[model samples]
Target: MLRYAATRILFLALGLLVASALIFATLRILPGDVAQMIAGTEGTPAQVERIRSDLGLDRPVAAQYLEWIGGVLTGDLGTSMLTRASVAGELAAKAQVTIPLGALSLVIALAFALPLGVVSAVRHRTRTGTAIGVVSQLLAAVPVVWAGLMFVVLFAVLLGWLPAQGFPRAGWQDPVGAIRALILPAVTIGIVEGAML
Candidate 1:
């Protein structure tokens, strides 16, 4: 058990290293200079060079990668180039919505899937079971983004039942509003996942 756990941890660390390296490499390869973007259209060449130097972008690629990975390992996500905000803080703020949406989606998926799956299994070969199976397959085949758009049209535009977009500025402080905002998204994700199940 100890050996297995250690092996898993080792592999997980290796995977992270490889993923991070690829991400860093990809960003480096992309067109457009980060310093130039930050400096904007009117920035002088001297300003761009200074911005690059300040960001340590003038260093060797390997040194930059090492510094970045080291900071990540130590729980410093570094500052965003555009926003100049803490990357970790930005991620944490987004997680407030993302985590809840995921949980609610799973809950809704399981709630519908479990009972419907059971009925479909028990009534195998019957018309009701066949209909349910067909519907599930159809739902599963629908693209999630398209489903979300259609749902927004039906529930938000036509029925005027929910807000079409954006999270509450107050976040969970406005519990009822938060949940209302999430309901359509959760249901859209849930329908697809439930169909798959």
Candidate 2:
């Protein structure tokens, strides 16, 4: 079991390396100069060249890839080209919302799926069981984005029970508002996930 686990870990690392390389290669081949974009239309040629030099875009492809991949492995996600902000910091900020939303979604999915799943199993071929099965199938078939939009229309627009978008500016400091904001989105994700469960 220990050996098997070690082998699996090795494969996971290898897979990640390959995937990262492919992604880097794809981005590198895409049209448009990153420095040019950052400098904008009015930027002089010398200014653009300086921007490229500052970003090390003047380096060989291999050297750039190695530097990027090294930074990633070291938890240094580097700076955003446009904003020049730390990518890691941005990701951490986003995680504040994403993590709670995911946890709430899981709770909702289990709360919904467990009881109904048991009921459907217990009733087997009965009319109620069949109906539940059909409903579950339909719910599962709905795209998650579409479900979110419909939920926004019903719960946020028509009924005005929840905010359609944006988290509380005060974050968890405003607990009630934060949870309220998440409800529609969580329900949209949870219900779809529940159907699959």
Candidate 3:
């Protein structure tokens, strides 16, 4: 089991590396100049060129990739393209929503999914087992966004129990409100993920 786990982890790391590489390569190949876009329509050639140089867009793709890889290794995710804000800071702020939602969803999913899975497997020959299996399959087929939207429609739109969009501006400061705000989204992601699990 340990060996299997290690192998899985290694494969997951490999997949992440490949995916990051693909993202970088795709961004490099995209049309139009990012520097020009940033410099804007009224900007002259010299200004655009300056912006490009400042952004290190003048560097070779290989050099840029190496720099990016080094920054990522050192926990420097670079700056936001539009806001000029620290990418890491933005990610950290965003984590308030993602982290709690993910953690809660995982817990909710596991707490319910495990037992359902076990029962379904155990009673495979029984009518109840067949019903459970069908339900699980049906849930697994539903998309995450659809589930989230349904939660919003039911809880936020219809019942007005939770906010439909946007996370708390104060983040986790108000613990009660934060949890309540996240519950719908968490349940949305959790239910779909748990069912798929």
Candidate 4:
């Protein structure tokens, strides 16, 4: 199990690196100036030039990429152009919400998919298995955003049972309150897996 985990981790890291390289290349190849994006259209020529130079946008793309990657290695993602704050800091703040949502989402997906997959495999020739497989395929076909919206309409708006969007912390003073807030979102994601299976 430990060896399998190490292999998975290695592959996951390589996947992430490849994805990041693709994203970086896409950003570089896209038709737009990063300097112009950072300094708005209304800025004076002198100001724009200064900003461009400051951001190293004046440098060759390869050089700029190396510098950016170097900053990332040193734990500095640079500043947000709009916020004028550290990008890493903003990410850290936002991650609190996003990370839990991601973790909860993964747990729910696995919990739903694993059992359904096992049942479907075991009951391969049974009518119940065929039905489950069809439903799973249909669920997989539906977009997550659409499923989330439907869930909000049904439980949050129509039934008034759960909160719609913002997530409450998992360890909120009242565990029940946190559960109430998360259950609907969890169900929405879980149902997608269940349907897909």
TM-score list, all predictions:
0.96, 0.95, 0.86, 0.75
Q: Give candidates' CA RMSD values in order.
A: 1.1, 1.2, 2.8, 4.1
Candidate 1 residue runs with Cα over 4 Å from true position: none
Segments in model 4 whose C-alpha atoms lie over 4 Å from true places: 1-22, 168-181
For 45-81, candidate 4 gives per-residue lDDT tens digits of 7888898888767778778777777888898898865
lDDT of 3 at 14: 94
Instruction: Please estimate how well model 3 matches the true structure, expressed as its whole-model Cα lDDT.
Output: 0.86
All candidates in order of lDDT, best leading = 1, 2, 3, 4
**Index of the highest-TM-score prediction:** 1
TM-score of 1: 0.96
Clash counts for the predictions, in order: 0, 0, 0, 2
Error of 1 at 39 (Å): 0.7
lDDT of each: 0.95, 0.93, 0.86, 0.79
lDDT of 2 by residue, 11-87 (tens): 99999999988998888799999999988999999999999999988988889999999999898999998789999
Please identify which of the two predictions, 2 or 3, would achieve the higher lDDT against the true structure.
2
lDDT of 3 by residue, 1-197 (tens): 99999999999989988898889989989998898889899999999999889888899987988889889989899996667899999998888788878899899899869999899999988998999888888988999898888878998999998887667677788787788888887787777788888
lDDT of 1 by residue, 1-197 (tens): 99999999999999999999999988988998999999999999999999999998899888999999999989999998878899999999999999999999999999989999999999999998999999999999999999999999999999999999768999999999999999999999999999999
The 10-residue segment with the lowest total lDDT in model 1: 161-170
Error of 3 at 77 (Å): 2.5
Candidate 3 lDDT trough over 10 residues, lowest sum: 163-172
Order of candidate numbers by TM-score, starting with the best: 1, 2, 3, 4
